[model samples]
Target: AVTRELALFKVACTVEQRAEILQIAEVFRSKTIDITEETITVEATGTSEKMDALEKMLANFDLREMVRTGKVVMARGTQIT
Candidate 1:
């Protein structure tokens, strides 16, 4: 599975504009999900074209933000013989 995630955009966006920006984000929800735990996650799935668009949108929304730690992951599956 492929996922796209946006982080720290809450801190990136000025507090005054966060609400309006979030409303705008609703239109771009696409196949992604945005989470709001201690660490945030903004992930989605779709074609490269769609993913690119969503990524650009997030970048624009969080221009000053950059991935701090990058990505960390683990595989999940059952072996079949």
Candidate 2:
């Protein structure tokens, strides 16, 4: 089976910290969906573990909010198991 999850992280950031935050998001293969003077929102999709790791990294900054979806699973073969 294959499993995946989606997460959105909102982190408070300063102008100087914006580049660093973007770098972390890049490393996680996440997309920066929204950005404001005070916050940056990142959208990530991967395994649960990956989401956890990304969250941990983002926590270094001022993590404002987080939203995560339940795991989505699908069978690999044509038949459902």
Candidate 3:
């Protein structure tokens, strides 16, 4: 089976930190879904481990909120009876 998780991270950061935060998001292949003067919302989708790693990295910053969905899995190739 293949599994993937989706997460949205809301981080509070100053203008000086925006570039750094964006860089980190880019490394995680996360998309910037929203942005404001004080916060940024990033969307990430990957395996659980990948999501964990991204969370860990973002923890260094002001991780204000996070929303994650349960694992989504699908069988590989044709169905087996």
The candidate that achieves the highest TM-score relative to the unseen native structure: 2
Q: How close is every model to the real structure, measured as TM-score?
A: 0.42, 0.96, 0.94
The global Cα lDDT (0 to 1) of model 1 is: 0.45
The lowest-lDDT stretch of 10 consecutive residues in candidate 3 is 72-81
- Cα displacement (angstroms), candidate 3, residue 50, comes to 0.8
Question: In candidate 1, which residue pairs clash?
Answer: 32-44
| TM-score-based ranking | 2, 3, 1
lDDT of 1 by residue, 5-81 (tens): 33333224565656645654566663224434222234444454555565576665554433333333434465332
Candidate 2 residues lying further than 4 Å off, grouped into runs, are none
Model 3: per-residue Cα lDDT over 1-81, one tens digit each: 888999999999999999999999999999999999999999999999999998998899999999899798888889642
Residues 1-81 of candidate 2 have per-residue lDDT tens digits of: 999999999999999999999999999999999999999999999999999999999999999999999799998989695
Specify the poorest-scoring 10-residue window by lDDT in model 2.
72-81
Better of 1 and 3 by TM-score: 3
Please state the error at residue 21 of candidate 3 in Å.
0.7
- In candidate 3, which residue ranges exceed 4 Å CA deviation? none
* RMSD to native, candidate 3: 1.5
